[model samples]
Target: MSEDNPHSSRGSASKTWLERIASLFNAEPQDISELEHIISEAANRQLIDEDTKGMLHGVLDVSNMRARDIMIPRSQMATLDIEQSISEILPTLLDNNHSRYPVVNEDKDHIEGILLVKDLLQFAFDAEAPAFHIRDLLRPAVIIPESKRVDALLKEFRQKRYHMAIVVDEYGGVSGLVTIEDILEQIVGEIEDEHDDAEDADIKKMATNVYQVSALTPLDDFNERFNTTFNEEEADTIGGIVLHAFGHMPERGESIELDGLMFKVSKANSRRLLQLQVISGKPPTATEQD
Candidate 1:
């Protein structure tokens, strides 16, 4: 019958294969679910890496997430009062180590403008100057609604070249703040700059035996620093080891002995320990104390 068309047979085979693949995929190839599966498959095949996938996922999530979800909570925000003196403002900025801070008057809810820490350097250099008012150095604050999507916020930030925004609730009260860096961090992960505090430093020797140690300090680093043999491959941080030893979350100021060293929880919350004050030497056992 007209020399059995080879092209028609090949076309039929391609259609069948595509239909079978679509059946296995369980969704239309052009749909969002299919796209996610494609990305996962690409990751599995090593065609695209995990980091790339993570960033892609982050970028996608930004469009879906709102300002309230990612904005730093008000409790954690380090704000500057425009009425404060240079001495007070300088120390506060130095302590927090932030580039920009929300300038407020009366209270945190009455935010006036953004303060660039570098602007204070001029006044710091010339303490004898007569007309260096804090209000003069303030940049116009960009206030955004809590419900604003991060994607839209990022676009506005880019268009206006604004780095920070004050997030406000429906009542127009200062809820919190969000930064351009925070939005980018979502897409690319945490951005640790030179000014950022070292999150991975070992036990900082504040004194001879007493030290300020992060709960996240590695067990190996802790052991090597203290010259102890408290080894455990199952745990990474000393906190994890402590948790394993205690079998529960220890409250703040709780002291416990492990591997001959005593650890006192210096900074902790309802959830977990932040920092511990460690002292070398055996603590008194319950039996010995009794």
Candidate 2:
């Protein structure tokens, strides 16, 4: 008999392992839950990473969500008045730091068109440019229904090559706006740029005596930064302390006073607080006193 080839045996073993792995993914998942189970199984087996697994689930979640679910409410939108001169418009643009603005009449519901910041750059650089007219540079705004599915909206965004859309209610009233980035954020989590506060920072000074604070900031850290004696034993984080003081879950814009500090819920979801606008009420610190 011919001597058995050792290489052939090793090759056969490798092929067998691959087939077993292939079988794991061969079956069609029966439903969303089944598909999630398959993805979880793959993660457990080290076939895919934890981050990839989360994104896969995010994609699945996005399919069930609507435009209204992630839209920036009308009250919070940064818009420009169509009748404003460049001098008046520039301040609002600079403060909001947005690339696009909805050009509206006196009422936000009366949206004129979208203004792209790049269109104004010609006036800034060219001395011989014609007088700036907001209407001359307006781009047609894309409108979508508030009930539009997020996944479908994302597909349309990709196909149309547009970044932003105005969302409207059933009665044709502008409810809010949603962007491609907002939908993508659901998949990849928050996409922070240089202007955004560093992820590790707990508190950021917004303006005179006003600060934007992460709800997750430790009570000890808050005390050290602001010269307060809030008891850490009662709650570990500023969020926990606020929750305890509220006696119930507080919605966005709700305000509370604790230990000379004014805490206003700046960002929150139905489940928990995400951020707070804190106004310092404590007596002047030693440096300020001096």
Candidate 3:
């Protein structure tokens, strides 16, 4: 047999873009479905360059993020109490885009462990089950120091197959928890699971002068949404603009005034931005801005 494909000539054919890339992946070993999903996502994102692709791959390979890096702060975490019945919480889970919730004893501070919706299903559905403390089904929350890197954490999670890790601050006190999805979002964009409602708006135009947008809004979409003349030659979106404008990477709440548009980083991490505050402005998109 030939070293390469014996049926074809020692050359390439002008197949459509996707088909060619598809050939590069092992259909069985690599899961062609995921391959198609990645390319489709990339195409939808309008990110076709080798550079961005390489950067994305690199970021994903090394989750060099700390617990303070990506954990949804306690204020943002959706949790459950040991007293809350599973029957009452299932609907809440469906609405909150969460597969698991922390089961706290006294409060979230005294988190006993996590309660996965899957594990609680039978109890919620079974009428004969005795009343039990949420603590009964809780799994000890994995705790990691705030300084952990995203890359190493990903490996740890994969090895132990852990889904969540609590982050501790300088005082070694509970800060927040990081989930598998949170780490993955560092590599890719926001990932909505089955629990996400169909009607949630990722980006909402709050008013004629405002937009309550998600942190994960892509650069191109922001450009289109605001009708602003942004320079994407060096970077692709407003988040890119912030990184380039600061002349260094930034964290959440960092602000950069560029051509009357102040990008107040509404959300970010050492990895990248999650959301930005696009100040109210009426700029034309007809010309590029410096």
Clashing pairs in 3: 63-150, 63-151, 64-150, 64-151, 65-149, 65-150, 215-274, 215-275
Determine which window of 10 residues in candidate 3 has minimal summed lDDT. 198-207
Pick the winner on TM-score between candidates 1 and 2: 2
Backbone clash pairs for candidate 1 read none
- Give the residue spans of candidate 1 off by over 4 A: 1-31, 200-290
Q: For residues 33-92, what per-residue lDDT tens digits would candidate 3 score against the true structure?
A: 455456556656675665456445546334444667567666556677777776767666
List model 1 lDDT by residue over 124-182, tens digit each: 67869676668989999999998999899999999999899999999999888999987
Per-candidate TM-scores read: 0.62, 0.69, 0.58
Predictions in order: lDDT: 0.73, 0.80, 0.64
Task: Tell me the deviation in Å of residue 116 in model 2.
Answer: 0.6
Task: Put the candidates in lDDT order, highest first.
Answer: 2, 1, 3
For residue 278, give model 2's deviation from the true position in Å. 9.5
